[model samples]
Target: MTNKPTALPARPHFSSGPCAKRPGWTPQQLATESLGRSHRSKLGKARLQHAITLTREILGVPDTHRIAIVPASDTGAYEMAMWTMLGARPVTALAWESFGEGWVTDAVKQLKLNPTVITAPYGELPDLAAIDFGHDVLFTANGTTSGVRVPDYDWVPEAREGLTFADATSAVFAQPVDWAKCDVLTYSWQKVLGGEGGHGMLILGPRAVERLESYTSAWPLPKIFRLVAKGKLTEGVFAGETINTPSMLAVEDYIDALEWAQSIGGLTALMARADANAAALDAWVRRTPWVEHLAKNAASRSNTSVCLVLPGLAEDKVKAIVSLLEKEKAAYDIGAYRDAPPGLRIWCGATVDTADVLALTGWLDWAYAQVTAA
Candidate 1:
């Protein structure tokens, strides 16, 4: 029998979304000046604008692109882009996981765009060469549920007739995004940044803005989804004036996270942290006999949501392992996504320390032994 590990991860917050907060983060670390003020107030607008500026700086988003704070986290931002800009062109939706499938449903059922759907099962990727760039393409940069990610943007053409809408909620900060290839990109504060939820960031390249000015959706857009007014893009929204009231507290928390990123040597450093954490977990997975990565290709594996499967284990047995880990408080929220294959999903984002991931491996071994022995 394997012995229970003595050391516990200092912070056992391995949830993929609302992920572990930055190292040394606390409520007191957030600024309170914007807390009670109106979002339209001078102080509030400046803070919101500051968050956008820091995002562009840290992400190295070119000046040609516009960034804005939107409502309802990543889902909201992604749907907003789809509702506003998709009907004008032929659509191609890619799915390799639950979230990607959700977008496919939206394109087929809700928008009635009758898009060409391309899919790969969990732990795999759709053929990149098969996609037609002549149509608007929608894909998640990282399969948050399946632990799969596109290796890079080299497959995308430099010039295309259609827009590339990248739902990059989990990829932003941890992965290098080729901004030129993505016309519409959306992410939320709650992902890699580990900030509070309920807010999203929408980034638009020059092409996306041109589409907004030229094309109008056939269906009626909700007040929150409207990006253009009087046939011109709403410039103020990109400049920190949001379409709806925002949670200033959340905005402050996001700013705090961005500033933390800047202090840690910017985007390169954040990517390095995530890479190191994932590498540590990968090392363990490689040596372990009972577990294997859900993602078969190392190049397509996600560094943020690193999923592992116990081959031949029944689903109930997998659940038992998850319950055991949580009961012991050795790990939290590391279970596989409900829709994903039965397995374990450990978040290895920039906020997570490699030591915590390593320590959790010992607990995983102990938990596996306990569960299997029964």
Candidate 2:
């Protein structure tokens, strides 16, 4: 073996999710006193509330939105919105990739709700004109699996009667989100924030909050999924007062990540870093032949989960090369999703440096040549 590629620091984690944390991350930043304590306790509640406040401030969420630090991960946040809002009317779901398809499946099958699914091939988004906002709408802000994203909120209907729920799990922090366009927005700590998995941050604008309060669902609200009670907004739950106990450790990790984002000049600076990193890889991708981006439209592409399809390679051979890359530590978790065609999925989110992306691209050039030669 030439040289075990320099290990990713002690914690140079580059997994697409539960990814590498931001620079200057430290466990000492966590308040140890809140660790073993009950979340309902005064100290525990304070820490939790602080985390909610800081995250909202970092993301530029509006004052009218209620942010909840929920028990489940991003999945929980999405499910909560579905259960609370989906039954009221017909649902139009736009699915372009795996995660988006999952939400559509949930709406049509799991939730047992009436729905219309408008789908595009893996690399493309649905026709925006087909979206009927007269009914409840569900979509993913960023398709984590395909590296495709909505270019902007301009396509969303401005004169819509129903609510819009967007799962922005991979897009938040890495890009700018227009809160005005979404009624319910969901994310997890493990994505851009690089915190431990387990906590879901659910942001509900006033319209979504009103739906939760006024709407009556035919199904039971799982203790973990309940968002409102007796036609009233569950204000306590959004204030770090959760319906169930949460992982203090994970919460602490999220706090550290948010503080790091703030110290580096908040969302604006973070967006610039993420865009620059993705652009570095995009420049390389444009020049490289073996790997091409899976996204069809450059404008609709995602800056965070940048996926590539290795054209002309046997799928099995691609898998073998991916294993070799991981063993070499040149790249890890770059394999395309199981449902997707064989390729590479590189995380170009803010936490990952532009220099590292360039280095990775250089290694990719070398690896592709080696694999093809074999």
TM-score computed on alpha carbons, candidate 2: 0.96
Tens-place lDDT per residue, model 2, 41-62, is 9999999999999988999999
TM-score of every prediction relative to native: 0.99, 0.96
Off by over 4 Å in 1: none
Task: Assess each prediction's global lDDT (C-alpha) against the native.
Answer: 0.96, 0.85
Pairs that clash in candidate 2: none
Clash numbers, per candidate: 0, 0
- Give the per-residue lDDT digits (tens) of candidate 1, residues 1-374: 89989999999889999899999999998999988999999999999999999999999999999999999999999999999999999999999999999999999999999999999999999999999999999999999999999999998899899999999999999999999999999999999999999998999999999999999999999999999999999999999999999999899899999999999999999999999999999999989999999999999999999989999989899899889989998889999999999999999999999999999999999999988999
